[model samples]
Target: IENSGDLIRAINLNGGSTMEWLVDRGGGQQIITVTPRFDQDAGRWLVGILTEMVGAHTERRSNPPWVALRDSFVNTWELLVLVKQGMSGAFSQGSAPQLSGPIGIAQIAGEFTREGGLAGWLTITILLSINLAILNILPIPMLDGGRLVFVMLEWVRRGKRVPPEREGLVHLIGFAVLIGLIVVISANDVLRLIDGRSFLGG
Candidate 1:
């Protein structure tokens, strides 16, 4: 309930009336009601509440809970690295495996289900998640981690930030590279579909 109030305040600050109303209604139902005059004030109140809750939760989870979490993350990273190396090596031996567009992925999913049962489909989903995570972490502009890198650098530099022009150029180059990769992968996927053979096998 305390966390919810903070979330509602943040939502109100962002010009969201529905959440504000809900919060108001919820507060009214309680014995002590604290009404905020401005949206920004409500947002700050909510953020403060959230900070307290998060701090408490973190303190509580600091020992044993975090150990399990750390182990899970390590296992996930190990799995990702293994799968990435295996797939890359397999593709590098010959032509790379094709990239799939939305339609292609659906087709592949249906085909996998028909050919190899539920286990094969599950494997595909897991592989796709790993691939997505790796791709997002690539040192390219316009990605979450890429932007986050810039943010870290800016913080380190204190006064200096990456110039907008340079940032724009980097993002443009990254976009072009990504597009070229997509095109090449899509072509390979199309060829594999037509020829009925894995591109890497050929």
Candidate 2:
């Protein structure tokens, strides 16, 4: 719920005046619609309240006396990890979606803007952010989440570590796969642009 609230707030900040409620359909499909009650002022107020709560908690911990500093640090670390996991889970699903390249995203953004005005563009931006967060947490080599996983394995094994050569190879493979996906998506974007279905007034 917190993550959803944050996403809503971000969309509002980006000039969205309508909320598009989405529901999952079978087999990765979704049903979405724009609602009338998502006024910008209400969204901003919610964001401000959440921000204040977060800031107050941090300030209280920071000003604690010297003797409590270590305990505070430990608590803060645990809280941070929980928050991060929550955020990651909010963005991720069991499988990856079709990845979009920069060109594809630009095309989609423009299309949305043309179809539904500012609110549509804002919705697309929010979804893109969620997609980006999910992609980063993938267990592919060279990503932060992948490194974190390796560290966990090392801890569990009490001494064993992933070999440097194997790690390098994994990263290289992931990089190549990512590049190929980008190329394919970009080509699709170009074709869509030529078909006049992408971008606003193109």
Candidate 3:
């Protein structure tokens, strides 16, 4: 490829797949075949090669507001699809997905900020926000979706609402369970850190 961006895009499009490259190393050209693997720490596919910038190039262009909005919608939809697929895979595997608690998230934020500057920080921030929104809407007790479920039940009962005391008890129990889950996940994060494992559970 002519540039790092092109190479990265190609790799991402290929995912973890084998690829062949033709290269000239002053002794004529040669073909190299390699396979990429998914790196949990890096959160991408890698072939264990590094590139250095020989020069700097910059280009600036402005897109119409409509175009930018369209792209934003498209990207958001793609992210949602990926999240759905990941959740499906995790369920099918009969194993819990790797999760990051506060400590792990903080580590990721710092790494991204250092490695990618403002763009990287903003990207991570946006992703976290999206994830949080999704969690908030999940049909778990003590969440908005849980309350919506109750509302639906009320409608099914011809406007007969659930007893206030019972609803409160359910929410209180939910809160306790949620806190317990947080504690457990946070403890896992600490143990991973002590073992020098990636906070991302690599």
TM-scores of the models, in the given order?
0.50, 0.46, 0.70
**Ten residues in sequence with the least summed lDDT for candidate 1:** 39-48
> What is the C-alpha local distance difference test score of candidate 3?
0.76
Candidate 2 positional error at 142, Å: 2.6
lDDT of each: 0.57, 0.58, 0.76
Question: Highest lDDT: which candidate?
Answer: 3
lDDT tens per residue, model 1, 42-67 = 11212223333444442133458879
Question: Which ranges in model 2 have alpha carbons more than 4 Å from their true place?
Answer: 1-99, 198-202
Which is better, 1 or 3, measured by TM-score?
3
Candidate 3 residue-wise lDDT, 36-121, digit = tens = 66555455556788977677687667899999899888877766755664554455455565677898788888777877899889
Q: Least accurate stretch of 10 residues (summed lDDT) in model 2?
A: 38-47
Question: Per-residue lDDT tens digits of candidate 2, residues 63-116?
Answer: 558757776566445444434433433344333333357987887787888876
lDDT of 1: 0.57
List the candidates ranked by TM-score, beginning with the highest.
3, 1, 2
Better of 1 and 2 by TM-score: 1
